[model samples]
Target: MEDRKLTVRSVERALDILLCFTRNDDLGLTEIAVQIGLHKSTVHRLLSTLEERGFVIRDAATEKYRLGMKIWELSTHLSRSDDPAILLLPAMERVRDHLGETVSLYLREGKERLRIQAVQSNQAIRRVAQVGARLPLYVGASSKVLVAFASTEEQEALLNDPEWPSWIDRVSYMEQLYEIRECGYAMSFEEREPGAAAISVPIANCHGVVTAALSVSGPVNRLSIDTLYEYAPYLMEAAHDMGLMIQ
Candidate 1:
């Protein structure tokens, strides 16, 4: 019984070490030890074991640790199995076909939003969304929609984060978030990539919790702000359908 308890405790500590990477992309041995309240020796042992399993990786030059490909592999598996991204592909495809642009589904991952699913446009000149892409949560329309509909505590945390670009107008951005909450959607022009434009709507689950952002994106020439507005109703309809699939 004592051996079993010790094994469980070790497992719990290892999980704590993995969770620490969610906040920061990388950490040194001592930083991880300090964060998890473990001695450096204990942390080192656990990290070595994790590294051996490809659950974590160490940077030889920086001597820092970050999550490894195995985590992504496991997540990919999870995303494939009854996940919202998989379930919402048809809706995304319909929106893409209707708008003649790329349609994508984004989910928040800590300080970033991840493109989990996408259907590309047939246009020769169009924006392309890569699945498994991560973008900051402060720029694009999908990012804004995800952050705008998040919990109040999360909003405050993001608003106060020091890593935001100096060019951002905080006051106006806050107001935009408020408008997004009121208007039910968001739009961005060249915020992340020049000549790129997108409009996004929040996708809420059956319990009214916003879980994802449904977006249509294309070249600025074809998807101006006005054009994006015209496409909003279709995006909203698809988002509503996706929401129903969540529960």
Candidate 2:
């Protein structure tokens, strides 16, 4: 029992060392030791083990430690897991039930947006979101939200792509993306599909990086632009809840 307790404590200290890099990209051994209230020698030993396991890297010049590629690789696996879908479903359902509209979780796939999960409304005339459906990232509310929060290089790549729809005015769309970023949401009516309307907000991970778009959508007749605006707070709250589950 004593040995098991010691093992757990060591594991906890190692995790603390890794978490120290969350606020600053890189940290010196003394900095980590001070932050976590551990002795320098103990911190060095733990960092050495972490570096060997590929969870941290030491810069030779400054001798500061930063997160290694293995962390990013593990994160990619987590993103691909079913955990996010399962964890976020309840929040999506809450929004769907409250608004009587379909709620969808969209992840960006290159120049397209894929519906990874959805909870459809029970209404007789409701918008149906088919999971695994890939739609262009150039027209709909969710699409715009994804693009708006995407990295600058990603936005430029999509804008310069030859497949960009000719009907979309690049300058105007750029302006809209700016607005979406400033307002923290996006809305569309009869843009992607006629008679369809949607309001979407960005879903950010623990690191504050936008990972997906959460949307509430329905037929235009039932979800007019004004009604969608009123529903924004609910959708935003649900999206924030879902984001908390990403990590």
RMSD to true structure for each model, in Å: 5.2, 15.3
What are the per-model numbers of colliding residue pairs?
A: 0, 0
Compose the digit string of candidate 2's lDDT tens values, residues 21-94: 74578999999999999999999999999999999999999999999999988967774444667788878888
Q: TM-scores of all models?
A: 0.72, 0.67
- Looking at candidate 2, the ten consecutive residues that score lowest on lDDT are 75-84
Q: Tell me the lDDT of model 2 at 149.
A: 92
**How many clashing residue pairs, candidate 2?**
0
lDDT of 1 by residue, 136-244 (tens): 9989999999989999899888878888677888889889999999989999999899999999999999778999999889899998878988888877877887898
Specify the highest-TM-score model's number: 1
Candidate 1 Cα RMSD after full superposition onto the native fold (Å)? 5.2
In angstroms, the error of model 1 at 183 is: 1.1
